[model samples]
Target: MSVKGIQPIVSEYHLLWEALQHYQERLEKFSSMSTDEDQQLKYDEKLQDMDGLLRSIKLAAKNDYQLDLK
Candidate 1:
C-alpha cells in the first residue's frame, strides 16, 4: 500500500496504544486503593473493556491487515 493509505492505520494504532496506556494506569491505581465490592466490580469491568479492545485489535489484524502487536 502507498504511504497515504497507511496513514490512517498508523494513526489508529497510536490512538489505541494511548487508550491502552490510560487503562493500564487506571488499573494500577485501582490496585492500590480500597477493595470495596463496588470498586472491585468497576475494576473488573475496566479489565473487560481492555480485553475487548485487545480482541478488536486482533480481529482487525486477522481480517484487515497484518499487525505486529507484540
Candidate 2:
C-alpha cells in the first residue's frame, strides 16, 4: 500500500541490516572456533567482504533515496 511502490525496497533495506547482523554473529562463531592466531586472521579477512558490501549498501541508500540509514 505504498504510494509509489517503494515499500518493498524499504523492507529490503531492513532485511539487509538483519543480514549484516547475522553475518557478524557467524563471524564471532568462527572466531571462537579458531584456537590459533593464524586461524583467526583467516576468518578476520572474511569480514572485509561483508563490510564492503554494507558500505556499498549504505551509500546506495543515501545516494539513491536520500535515506539516512540507522
Candidate 3:
C-alpha cells in the first residue's frame, strides 16, 4: 500500500481542484449576501479573480503543465 510515481502536473491538478471548490463556496456565500455598491464591486472583483483562476486551470489541464499557475 504505497503511493508512488505521481507526477507534478497531477499533483497540481489536485491542488487546483481543491482551490476551485473553495472559491466556489466563497462565491456562493457572497452571492447570497446583500451588499452596498462598494461591496458589490468587491464581489465582482472576487468573481473575476475566480474566473481567471478557473481559466488558467483549464489551460493548464489543456497543456499538461504544472507550472502554469505562474
Candidate 4:
C-alpha cells in the first residue's frame, strides 16, 4: 500500500519522540540495575507513565493530525 502525502514536521512530534527515547533509555538502565521494594514501586510507576505517554503520543498523532505514526 502507498503512503499519504507530506506529513507535518511539528515540534510536538519531535519532542514526543525524544521524550519516548529518553524514557526508553531510562527504563533500560533501571531494568539492568537492582532495586529495593520502595525503588521497585517507583520504577514500576515510571514504566506505567511511559506506557501511557507512548499511547497518548500515538493517539495524538492519529487523531489530531490524521497521521498514523506507526
Candidate 5:
C-alpha cells in the first residue's frame, strides 16, 4: 500500500492509544483518591495489569508491524 493508504491506519492507532492512556490516567487518579486499602490494592493490581498489556501491545506493534507507537 501507498503512504496515503497507511496514514489513516496509523492515525487511528495513535488515537486509540491516546484514549487508552487517558483512561489509565483517570484510573490512577481514582485509585489514589480511594481511602480503602483493599480497594486501593485492587486498583493498583489493575493498573499493573494494564501497564503490562500496554507494553505488550506496543512491543507487538513495533516488532510485528514496525510501527512506533510512541
Candidate 6:
C-alpha cells in the first residue's frame, strides 16, 4: 500500500490511543465511586475498550507503521 493510504490508519491509531488514555482516567475515577456495582461495570467496560485499543495498536505496529503514542 502507498504511504498515503497508511496515513489515515496512522491517524486512526493516534485517535484510538488518545481515547484509551481518556478511558483510563475515567476508569480511575470510577474506581473511587461509592456505588460498587454500577461503578465496577463501567470500569470493566472501560478496561475492555482499553484492551481493544492496545490490541489494535499492536496490530498496526506489526504492519510496520509508527503509532507514536508519546
Task: Output the number of the lDDT-best candidate.
Answer: 5
Q: Lowest summed-lDDT stretch of 10 residues in model 6?
A: 1-10
Q: Top TM-score: which candidate number?
A: 5
Clashing pairs in 4: none
lDDT tens digits by residue: candidate 6, 1-70:
3344453467666676677778787787876674788868878877787777677565655565754455
lDDT of 2: 0.72
Q: Give per-residue lDDT, candidate 6, residue 1.
A: 30
Q: In candidate 2, where is summed lDDT lowest over 10 consecutive residues?
A: 1-10
Better of 2 and 3 by TM-score: 2
TM-score of 3: 0.61
Order the candidate numbers by lDDT, best to worst: 5, 2, 6, 4, 1, 3
To one decimal, what is the Cα RMSD in angstroms of model 6 from the true structure? 4.6
lDDT of each: 0.65, 0.72, 0.65, 0.66, 0.74, 0.67
Name the lDDT value of residue 16 in candidate 3: 66
Off by over 4 Å in 1: 1-8
Model 2, 1-70: lDDT tens per residue? Answer: 2344444375687687678869877987897798998988877887777777677777766766666666
- TM-scores, all candidates, are 0.60, 0.67, 0.61, 0.64, 0.73, 0.53
The lDDT, on a scale of 0 to 1, for candidate 1 is 0.65
- Candidate 3 regions with alpha-carbon error over 4 angstroms: 1-8, 65-70
Candidate 5: lDDT of 59? Answer: 63
For residues 10-70, what per-residue lDDT tens digits would candidate 1 score against the true structure?
5676577677868867886885584797887788788778877777665564445566554
User: Candidate 4, residues 1-70: lDDT per residue as tens digits?
Assistant: 0135334355667676677868877876785584676776677788888778777677667765666654
